[model samples]
Target: MSKILVTGGLGFIGSHTVVELQKEGFEVVIIDNLSNSSINVLDGITAITGKKPIFEKLDLREKSAVQEFFKTHNDVKGVIHFAASKAVGESVENPLLYYENNINTLVYVLQELNKLKEANFIFSSSCTVYGQADELPITENAPVKPAESPYGNTKQIGEEIIKDTCKVSAQLNAIALRYFNPVGSHESALIGELPIGVPQNLVPFITQTAIGLREQLSVFGDDYPTEDGTCIRDYIHVVDLAKAHVVALQRLLAHKNETNFEVFNLGTGTGSSVLEVIKSFERVSGETLNYKIAPRRAGDVIAAYAHTEKANKVLGWKSDLTLDDAMASAWKWEKHIREQ
Candidate 1:
């Protein structure tokens, strides 16, 4: 089995991707600083996958540490870069933190990978790179507008960095998966989104409020131009998103990429408003959530979903879980953790 390096492997999407990769007979080495993630997540991943990935509690910001990691794990055949500060609201207030953590780490990793004889890279890009898309369903070719937040800008810059690096480094093959909102947890009710502080994402906030960890879920904005007057996003199940990572990795490993660097959008080709998400949670969890419409947040796009035709056809993968399914799993995980 080819060894794969999963930066931030203990994080929400990263842990789930590690599970999928391990199940597919790939050896995973995880490097996480444990800033936004918990060490307990390692146990959850081991429980679910029946194998514990090799883990190193190292921060990627230190260029020397990153170079040392590549030296030690030179056998690693591929890299899935997911370690970064991801909150949009936080990034708006602290732009330098986003740049330092997101941009610097990416450059260091790429520099080391460039030294390798062959490198397969999967960048954990976000749909925020599209900013406020002019079209309803964003495609891979959609022009990246001015980023609304520093977090979004980092993703845009990260993709550009990979493209430019791959252009010069013939040994490096890369793909940027610009995925939308990922919700839900594994069916085992283990290894879910464990935000260190107050939850940043919508689904976790909804679950926390219902479980009494929070007083009320503040719906970011209710004046957006939408059916419910709230911001809209495509909420794909995290499991589906994780599986897509494996598919993309296999594409590169098999030398199936038509070009050295490719881009794909991972999403369920549908959009849901904030109110609609709350309704889905209520329907699935049988709990009435306490929420109020708040002012529109800065760095928020009115709406964004995906066309997903390219991902479906090129990667041969599509999201299989529905909104209700994701909400139910997330609710179940929330309850499970509280009970413990």
Candidate 2:
């Protein structure tokens, strides 16, 4: 069995990917600093998979530590990098931190991989890179606009770095999956999103509000030119997004004479407005949610979704879960965390 290393394995997306990788019969090792997540997520993962991954508490920002980690785990076949400071609002306030953490860690990891004879690398990119795309159902060929915020810029820069690195390095092959609004939890609800402070994403905030952890939701602008006059997004189930990473990794390992770098969009290909999401949550949980229309957030896009034909055609993967299913699964996980 080939062993794989997942950075930020304790995070929301990383944990789900770990479960999916384990189910595919891969030996998994995780590296996390526990800065924005908890070790308890390991228990949640084990509860569902009945197998715990090998984990190391190491921060990738430290150059020496990252070098030593790769040295110690020299046999790692592929790397799935999910570690980064990913808050848009916070990134604006602290741009340097985002640049350092997001850029430095990726460079360090790639540096380590450059030594290997052959290695596959998967990076977590975001739809924010396509700021207010001129067209609907954005594709991988969509032109990347100037990033709206520092956080989004980091993702753009990260992708560029990987592309440049792959240009000269024969040992590394990379795929950057540009994701659009990943939400929901695993079906078992044993492992789900665990936001540290106030939740930045829509589904988590909605779930927290339903559980009374938060008093209400903020619908950031209703003046946008759309059916509901609010921002729209393609919310993909976390599990489906997780499965894409595995497929991307497999593709990199199989293909030869392929460009060392490639990108694919991961989304449901359907747009959902903020109002629609709240309504869906209310229907799923049978709970009234308090919300107010606030001013437009500075960095938010009015609407964005994906044209997933590339992923579907190339990787033979498509999202299987629906919005209602995502909401229900998230609500179940919220309840489980509250009781525990």
Candidate 3:
């Protein structure tokens, strides 16, 4: 089994990916600073996979520590980089933090990968790069627009950095997965999105409100030009997104990449409004959510979903879970975590 390094492996999506990788017989190592995630997630991963991956509490932003990690684990066959500050609102307020955490750390990691004879790299990217696309279902061929937030800008810059790095580093092959909103939890109800403070993402916030952690959920807007007059996003289950990472890795490892640098959009290809999400949560959890229609949030697109045919036919992966399924699993995990 080839050893794979998953940065931010203890995070919501990262933890799920670790379980999937372990189940696939891949030796896994995790690097997380526990900034946005907790160490206890390893237990959830172990419970599911029956194997605990090697974990190191290291921040990728520290260039020396990142290099040291590569030195300590010289046998790493591939790297999946996902340890970045990901909140759009927070990024708007703290732009420097987003750049340093998202961009500088990426450079440090790629620099270390350049030292290796050969490497396969998978970058955790977001669909925010589209920035309110002109078309209904955004495709990989969609022109990259000006990012609406600092966090989105970081993803755009990160992809550019990888493309440029891959151009120079002939031995490196990388893929950037521009994923849509990722929700849900592992079916075991052990690991899920554990936001430190108030939840930034909608699904977690919805769960928190239902669980009484929050007074009420705020629907960002109900005036947008959509079916529900709210912002629409393609919410794919986190488990499905994790599987896509594995598929992208296999493509790079098998030398199937047409170019050293490539990208794929991961989503369910169906847009769901914020109100619809709340409705889905209510249906699955059997709890009427206390939500209010709030003002439109900054940096939020009216509608953003994916044209996942590329991911479907090219990467051989498509989202299998719907909004209801994701919300149901998230509700289960929320109840489980609260009772713990």
How many steric overlaps are in each model, in order? 0, 0, 0
| lDDT tens per residue, model 2, 90-129 | 9999999999999999999999999999989999999999
| Cα lDDT of model 3 by residue, 1-340, tens digit | 9999999999999999999999899999999999999999999999999998999999888899998899999889999999999998899999999999999999999999999999999999999999989998999999999989999999999999999999899999999999999999999998999998988889889999998999998887789989879999999999999999999998998999999999999999999988888889989889999999888887778999999999999889988888899999999999999898
Task: Quote each prediction's TM-score.
Answer: 0.98, 0.98, 0.99
The lDDT values for all models are: 0.94, 0.93, 0.93
Prediction 2 TM-score vs. true = 0.98
Candidate 2: list runs displaced more than 4 Å. none
Which ranges in model 3 have alpha carbons more than 4 Å from their true place? none
Give, for candidate 1, the lowest lDDT window spanning 10 residues.
Answer: 292-301
**Per-residue C-alpha lDDT of model 1 across residues 1-340, encoded as one tens digit per residue:** 9999999999999999999999999999999999999999999999998998999999999999998998899999999999999988899899999999999999999999999999999999999888899898999989988888899899999999999999999999999999899999999998899887898889999999999999989998887889989999999999999999999999999999999999999999999999999999999988999999788887788999999999999899999999999999999999999999
**Cα shift from native, residue 19, model 1 (Å):** 0.3
Worst 10 residues of 3 by lDDT: 292-301
- Per-residue error for 126 in candidate 1, Å, reads 0.8
